[model samples]
Target chain A: MALLILPIIIPFATAILSLLFRRSAAAQRAISLLGATALLGAAIALLNVVWSDGIQATQMGDWPAPFGITLVADAFSAIMVTLAALTLLATVVYSLADIDVRREAFGYYPLLNVMVMGICGAFLTGDIFNLYVWFEVLLIASFVLMALDGDQAQMKGAIKYVVINLIASTLFLVAAGLLYGLAGTLNMADLAVKLRDVARPDLVATVAMLFLIVFGIKAAVFPLFFWLPDSYPTPPAAISAIFAGLLTKVGVYALIRVFTLIFVQDVAYTHTLILVIAGLTMVAGVLGALAQTEFRRVLSFLIVSQVGYAVMGLGLYTSGALAASVFYIIEDVVALQCLFLVSGVVYRLNRSENISVMGGIYRTYPGIALLFLIPALSLAGFPPLSGFFGKLALLQSGLAVEQYAIVATALVVAALTLFCIGRVWSDAFLKPSPAPGSAGVLVRSAALSSSRAQMIGMLIPVVVLVALVIGIGLLAEPVFGLATRAAEQLWSPSDYIQVVLGEAL
Target chain B: METILAFVVGGLFAAGLYMMMRRSIVKLIIGLALLSHGVNLLIFTAANLTRANPPIVPDGAKQPLPPVADPLPQALILTAIVISFAVLSFALVLLHRVYQAVGTDDIDRLKPVDE
Candidate 1:
């Protein structure tokens, strides 16, 4: 119970403290670090508790589940919470050296804390309406963070991000409202039980599809992804890393949660829809990446592409497939963050995010180049890395389902992703620096102390993440077992309802 | 009553979408405002329309909520309105800064460096 609530409470409390001590940079950093560390510890502890003793739930204010908000930490939520907390801690450290300290000291840390709170809350909540609340909390924080620098690019990005998210939030609200009207309940577990009793299958399917569209926009799937690449790159590197690591994954997590639990019987239509979208998302995302010459822009496109792998697993609709999707999501979040952090280093070294102007950086920053290589190759599904295992599992599962066309397209898209990332490597690191670059001067100066600090701070977490990915890859049996358990829990949903409502309907 | 409210909400949603697609920053703000209002109304309607009274307990009553409005949706709308207000203000400030920095409110003028 304590562990379930601490991840949210720690950050929120620290955010308030940060605001009160905004004028003191030292105090702000201390508070933020403390909060992040506490969150990480809490998340890990919760994971242990859940692993030892199944799923856990705590009703806020001691009210029963149906009438009061509940914070539930299942295997899936536990893992996501831990990942979000760890990424947040790393981003905080990265921001210490990278951010314009004097300008951002007051608001940035608080906003980041609030954002983490929202994310953790979103993962932990058991009420549908409360999930919407957490989404708004995170979205609002992201809007401020996106526009933090208040530059032209940031503003443009912020506008598009906000408008798209606002629309998505509205859609989410409408879906929740409709669901509540039909079921007369807003509690997720209760709704799952009552939804089974509802006679209108079409209405259930309609509301479920509406939810997919809303969450789809957030996850940057297929036609809904145009806003992501356009907006994400403009934020500062720390914010970008956190966003890359956590935001879309939350949407994906929600999609898995709702679809698997509430709409399990509609797998034929839903899975097919997901399959078609997944294929298109992968192909289109890589194509977008191929068309980009900018470092962050290409990374953004890859985010969309990687998301398709996760969606593909869900579409396959088997225990192995769902587990693979879970694995892919975790791998994608870690690998994407690593690549984005490396891109930040590239931008710092070259003073340009455009690949056309960046060259021979690997010679100057071998360590950073290597860090970038790990995630890049991993993302391309290279052997021995986490990304390879995730893709392998997804592809194998798709084949098992005899989704041969999807399997073939996924493989082709994987190749294209490899090509696109290789292009980024060549253009940005291997090739000679373009002579008389228009973006900026090509004066190869030693890295700034601040930049070096930022790089080291960022690299530590990437290293940790990569090592974890490798661990998961090596010990796939246990991890996949846990994921299978989670999938079973989701498929049945009886335990979830029993835990929340004290008895299954 | 529910049908009329739904039509009004739908019209507002269409209008908001149209305004959001425009190039002007001010129009975008207006669009968000309209969109939020529509969403609030939609939520209200989804709670099932009731006209008798607000959801409040009467003195010495066991369960005094017959034909009363759903207080949950109303509370949620209140929060949404507050959040949207904050977002709108922040957007206004950001737009002001963008205009000052770039000398234009036209999104087209803010094209990517590659473009």
Candidate 2:
């Protein structure tokens, strides 16, 4: 029980401490790093417990499941929490070098801790309403972080991001309310049980659709994702890294949870809708990236596209498909974080984010060039890297289910993704410096201003994350086994509910 | 009475959607407020209505009587309302920030950095 709650508590406590010490950058960084290390350790411990003991669960205040809030961790939630804690650890280290003292003084670490708490809470909560509250917590924190500098572009992005996200939240509230009206419980396990016997199946399905739309906005699916490209690129690279890496995947996680757990009665219609959305999301997102000249904007659109691969896994709805989705999320999160971190370094080197203006990073900083290629190639589904296996699993699942159209879309999108990523490689790395604004000369001069400490701070996280991406690719079987277990639990929730509420409670 | 309130909720939803589609940020916020209230009432009415007695167990009963309103949805709405209020206040402050930085409330004029 303590194990189940520690991931949430550690971050919450760290957030408070970080806030109290906000005025001193050194103290704040110390608290934040200590908090992140502890969180990662707690998450790993919790993962071990859940793996050995089976789904660990505890109800708050001794209240039973339907009447009281429960915190539960099956393999999937534990894995997500672990992923988040790992991301937080990497980000905090990166922030030490990347965040200006101004933003750090402006409550960055505290808000970051709050966001971490919110994310972990969302993953661990056994109640639907509780999940919504956690979503709001992380979101409000992200809002402040995105607009931290109050630059014109950041402000514009923050406005669209906030407004659209608020609508998504309101929709989630309405859906949760209506679901409660239709069924008598908010506990996910109880709802899964109650919803099976509900008299009105169609109404339940409509509520499911409402959930689909709500999470879809957050996942940045096609036709609903215009706000993402506009907003994501405007934040600082580290802030962008965290948002890009973790936030959208939470939406995907919720979609997988609700569809797999509560509203499985009409998978035929709903799953197909998801498949259709996944196809369009892939096509539109990659095509959108093709038009973007700025490095971050291209990456932003690429995030939308890659999200489709995971959603496609859910759309397929088989155990293999869901397992593939989980694996895909792990690879994508690390890759996206690395890509954004590299983008920041690229900005430091070239003095711009425009690919047209960037040249000769390969000649000047081969290490940074290699770092960029690791994620860029992984994101495009290159061979023997983490993304290759991630995409292979997804494609295999799609083929098994005969989702031919989406499978085709995935392939076409993959090729186009390479094309777009290739655009960056040629412009930023391989090409000689453009005649008038020679990037090599500019970078050499700026190296004086860009302190070596800052460079190490940025590069350390990239190295750690890239090593992870390679490790996941090399050690695919153990990770894949874990994902298989997670999918099985999602498919069959009896163990989950009984663990949470007890056998007879 | 339930039908009348349902219509009122529908009307608010319509107005909210209309306002949100406009170019100005302030109207967009007002629209959000209206949408939230509409959804809250929708929850209230959808959970089934009762006025005969409070949803409390009597002196010796283990459970409230069937005709008593379900207290769960009411509690859900209360939580929803508070969350929406918190978010609404945040959205308003964000709007003011955007306006200060961009010098415009119109959404169209705010696209200075985009392609």
Candidate 3:
């Protein structure tokens, strides 16, 4: 019970402390690091408890299950909490070097921790209405983070982001309200039980579609993703990396949770709709990536495409497919964070994000090039990397289900993803230096201004993340097994309901 | 009462959507505000309306009486109102800062970030 609440509490406390120490940059940094470390520890501990002890649930204020707000952790929620903590730690370390001092003093660390708290809250909350509250918590935090610099591009990007996201929030509120009207309860497990018995399954399905659209916007699936490429590249690389890594996946996580747990009555209609969206998302996102010439923009589009693979797993609606989706989400989060951080370093060197003007990174900083290469290749689903196993699992599950259409789309998208990454490689890394307007000769001179301490601060997180990715690849069996276990837990909602509401229900 | 509020909610939603589609940034903020208000009302009505009876347990009772109002929807609306208030205020400030920085209130005048 105590374990279930610690992940949310640790980050909430960290954010408060960081906010109080905002005037002192050094103190803020120290507090932020300590907080992230503690969060990761709490998350891992929680995961350990969930792994061995089945599922854990605790109601707020000692209130009983159906009427009170409950926090619950199954294998899936625990794993997500752990992954979020890991990403938070990496982003905090990277921010030490990547974020300017002015931004740090402007409450960056506090907002970051608060955002993580919101994310962990979203993962752990067993109440549907509480889930919406967490979404707003993270949404508001991210809104500030998006416009933290208040520059022209950031502001412009943030406006679109805020407007579209606000609309999604309102829709989510409506969905939750209507759901309450239907189920007479806000607890997710209770909703699952009641929704299954609701006489009008059609109304339940309509509400389910409302949820799909709401989370789909948050996930940036196809036809709903234009705002993503525009806004994601505008933030600082550390901010961008964390947002890219965890934000949409939360949307995906919610989709998986509600669909698997509460909205299973009409899977034939809803899951099929999701399958179509998944295929379209993959095709459209990769195509968008193929069209972009900017470094960060390409990465932004790739994020949209990668989200499709996770959604496809949910769409496949099998235990194996869901496990594959969970595995892919893990690999994608780490790789995307590393790739964005690499983009930050490269942008710092070249002073431009344009691929046409950027060159000589491979020759000048082979380590940086390798850092970029490993993740980029992994994202492209190359063999011997974690991405390969993630994709292979997804494809195997797809084939097993005879979902040849989406499987075929996944393959073509994979090939195109490789091509896009190659384009970035050749233009930004392998090509010889362009004329000395700014990129080539200036890179070496720019290196001098960035203190060695800053460089260490930057490279450490990148190295750690890359190493983690490679470790996952090498140890794919254990990691995949863990994901499979999570998928098994998700496949049986009865276990979730039984644990959360106890046998009384 | 539910039927009346349902139409009012639909009307508010329409007005909000229309305002949002306008090219002016201020209208966008107003639209956002209206939309949230509409959602609050939607929740209020959707939860099944009750009379003025309060959702309080009497001195000796363990739970509220059978005919008492359902307090859950009101609580949900209260929370939603606070959140939307925060978000709308932030959006307004953001719009103001955006105008100051970009020197435009016309949404189309702001250059696309992709450029």
DockQ of each: 0.61, 0.73, 0.80
Going through the candidates in order, what is the number of backbone clashes in each? 0, 0, 0
Error of 3 at A279 (Å): 0.7
For residues A1-505, what per-residue lDDT tens digits would candidate 1 score against the true structure?
7888999999999899999999998889888888899889999999889888988999999988888898998888888998898888888877776777754664999999999999999999999989999999998898888888666667777777887898898889889888887888888888888887689989989999999999999999998999999899987777898999899999999988888777765889998999899999999999999998778999999999988888888888887888889878877888888778777767777777778888887777777777888888889898888889888999899889899999999999999998998898888888877776465543322444454556676667667766776777788678777777677776677788888888434
lDDT of 2 by residue, B1-115 (tens): 7899889989999999999999999999999999999999988887777776678888898987767766777788888889889889988888888888888899888884743
In CAPRI terms, where does candidate 1 land? medium
Model 3 iRMS? 1.1
Winner on DockQ between 1 and 3 is 3
**A1-505, model 2: which lDDT tens digit per residue?**
7988899899899989988887789999999999999999999999999889899989899887789999999999999999999999999999999888789989999899899899999999999999999999999999899889767888888988998998999899889878887897889989988898889999999999999999999999978999999999887788999999999999999999999989999989999999899889999999999998888999999999999998998898899999999999989999998899888888887777778878888998888999999889999999988999889999999999888888888999999999999998998788986776554332312432578888998999999999998899899899889988898898788888788778645
List lDDT for all candidates, in order.
Answer: 0.84, 0.89, 0.91
Query: Which prediction has more favorable TM-score, 2 or 3?
Result: 3
Report the C-alpha lDDT of model 1 over B17-109, residue by residue, as the tens digit.
Answer: 899889887887788889889988988888887776766778888766688767777877888788778878877887787788678877677
Better-scoring candidate (TM-score), 1 or 3: 3
Q: Candidate 2, A457: how far from true, in Å?
A: 0.9
Poorest 10 consecutive residues by lDDT, candidate 1 chain A:
A442-451
- Assign candidate 3 its CAPRI class: high
Order the numbered candidates by DockQ, best leading: 3, 2, 1
- Report the number of backbone clashes for model 3: 0
